[model samples]
Target: MTTREEVARKAGVSVAAVSYVLNNKPGVSDATRQKVLEAIRELDYKPSHAARTLKTKKTNQLTVFVNYLGDAFEAGILNHLEMESRMFGYFVNFQTYHPEREEELRHFMAGRIDGVFLLGQSLRPETLETLHKAGIPVISVMKPVEPGPVTAFVDIDWTASLQKTIRHLKSEGHLRIGLMANLSETHAHRTRTLAFRQAMKAEGLPFGETDILSGGGRLEAAKAAMLDYIRIGRLGEHTAFVAASDLMAIGMLTACRESGIAVPDRLAIAGCENVLMTLQTTPTITVLDYPRPEASVAAVRLMVEAIRGEPVASRLFDSRLLVRQSTHMGG
Candidate 1:
């Protein structure tokens, strides 16, 4: 099928300009419109009926771009985003994001979705520019970095949350503390790592590269790393571990279980994101209760406001700790 994207590429014009010309909208200059029409004729472009209708009016469709749909926390946020977006006459769809999939994402922008909710992927500069020219609002959820043409974002105060967790661990008499986190070079991962350093410094504790372990942000990876740490004799005496995610903590628990180390008694552990799997672990993982629903609602609200050309500001939410058997002092 010859899409408007092909016509836009052939005519050397923006996709929005092609859309304007095809729908008889008054946005593109006459010269550009003529060029687009010529390109359309040359390419024999034929849009689908739904695409034809979208060129003329709003489609009321929103996209939720995720790094991975299997993530428990992201799945919870998707569920809430879909449910809340319905009140504004918007429906949500999922899209997997990877740096190499820029062309696929651009092809998806043939006047289909009204806005996008980015969960964890960073859009390329050209993709952001194209979306901007198309007048599409892009709101990121739990993205701490500043937007580069993105409309708005929602995130949590990672420094404060991590500090609180660290203080609690210290108060529980855990003097030798270490951190386990995903090795991905994302804003959230950096924020968590920095916050861990700041919190340890505040508590007058030692923070070094040797104490911070990277597990590539997967369950098996974390488990393997922990087992290696055990074999390397790095699971020091009376140590407390903090993971950047609940899945990592669960993997750490598994390592401890197989090594015959008692949780909380010998090795206290805490994790971020209080997902369902936290409770399902052998020793329920202590985790941070991230405001998933609130963040989802905020993202939807920002998108709706931005789509209407209304001013919107980025938002930040707070996190609370959920103490469980994984780190309970009494246990």
Candidate 2:
């Protein structure tokens, strides 16, 4: 394999210069940096991550912990996080944690990683405290738990986002709305569910006990919940359905289609996260675009600053509703 020494020899520069250019250090001139990069490409050189970590006293690795919700929406967010971390000269390690497990929290605090990205429902206060005590920085990608000293987060105002959707449905003259939620122990799911309830109440809408469907955020579970609702003769009775994630929304739609229920005519469904599959469906799903890519990039930037002991700013992005064919009421 081609080493940094070989690239430096080919580029007629010192190994230190090659290191500076490869690591994106600011001292090297642009022209010399270009020459070193050209040589690296010609020689197909790859740096040793271990050696780099040892030299810098940094793992150059970030860990992300996501709840066990294996939906397309979560997958899309993970993809963006991976891409953004790469651009910031760090590798990402993702682990699934049980939200209710205190042991999992302890294990995460064992200092295996430089920093952590939390992508689940709200984190426990104790967990935050422990991580803070360990001097580990955490950035929440989508779910912001209560604020603590060491935690920084970026997320949309979920309550307002759901209220907008509820208002849009209300304008369509739909007074009764059904909700499909994962109801998991994670902070994100809980927050979205609470927002849905609050929006329904604020809009003076009657969300009957029969109108709420519980699922596991899996397609099959969501489909089953919808099917049960239909079997109980409650599908078309509610004018609209609100789902916590696009996967659940699509599942609800699939169940509706199989039962010969027309979308937007008999039932309108909307979801969060705006996954690609939601757009490619027959009647596209209306959803809230959370800008996961931008959030991921921003999180990495903050993580890098924190790693360098530099002051960083907290950020939050607004969620926008994308009106699609599924909720085709003139907005």
Candidate 3:
């Protein structure tokens, strides 16, 4: 815990001289530099990384901001981002982005990270503007619901994916379908919800407000929501469900177990953003492979390009259905 002032006092030189020596900047004599180096060694002083970053104009560090780190889909994306970014000599940092934690995110990201990766977290226009004005490059892992001059973004076509999922369920003779979407309003959720409505209309199926339930992006919350639907007899009509996320699908599966409902027999379920845990469920849940690994690679590549003053472009990956034990056989 040695300060430049202490080093200066010990070396019998001004603080500015110690700074110049530590940062390898000009305007310090060799004798003064040697004295400062000796004082630093004697005191076992380590230069501040924050101060050093300011002097060098780079931290070799990037940040990945997520709404929740515990989410399996997000975790998978983060894993790939870290691995790919490291190959380029960049270290990754993580921060949680919540509505209540906006101020904390702003303060933490200011001039600290060389770049940022936003994973499905919505930001205010002002916040985005501030980051743009600061000359910090930011890449979004999901398309923002609101349009802005964001540096870059990567996403998949949720509407087309959901339409395919619904068509599969319909072809399997599922008359009534329900949607499990997160409570929070995000571009992914909104797109999926709208897709569900459009698909239901195309198939001539009835869609009701109650048919779209909030999955809440948590195991416990989704289970509780499904349990509530069951208690009210609302769950009896829907033959199949399309969940916005795998965690919510797993939660609904748990609810079906507690209610003596047999999956793919009395009810079928499918999830978006397939995670590894989906294979571990009692009856493996069907899901849409989100191609997040590829998105991760693309995000990092675009971010590094933007960091290097190269032109950047947004990217979109593909999503495909993966049938499993949770859903009935279909054409």
Model 2, 1-331: lDDT tens per residue? Answer: 8888999999999999998886667899988998999999899898887677557545667878876546666777778888988887778988776666756766745555678888754666777677667656888776554455545767777888888898888877788888888776555777788778888888888876667789777777998998988898765578888888888898988998999888878889998888889878868999999888888788788887777667777787778888888888542
TM-score-best of 2 and 3: 3
Write model 3 residue lDDT over 1-331, tens digit each, in one string.
Answer: 8887899999999988987776556689899999999999998888888788777666778988877778888899999999999998889988777777777777777878788888856677777877777778889888766546778889887767777788888878887899888756754456567767877787788998978888787878888999998898886679999888899999999999999988988889999889999999988998999998899999999998998889999987788999888886531
Flag clash pairs in model 1. none
Q: Can you tell me which runs of candidate 2 are displaced by over 4 Å?
A: 1-57, 100-111, 123-130, 145-150, 208-210, 311-313, 329-331
Q: What ranking emerges by lDDT with the best candidate at the front? A: 3, 1, 2
TM-score of 1: 0.81
Model 3 lDDT, residue 228, Cα = 90
Worst 10 residues of 1 by lDDT: 182-191
- For candidate 1, lDDT tens digit of each residue in 235-299? 77438999987778888899899999899888998988899999988788888899998998998
Give the TM-scores of the predictions, in the order they appear: 0.81, 0.78, 0.82
Positional deviation of residue 81's Cα in model 2 after best superposition, in angstroms? 1.9
Judging by TM-score against the true structure, name the best candidate.
Answer: 3
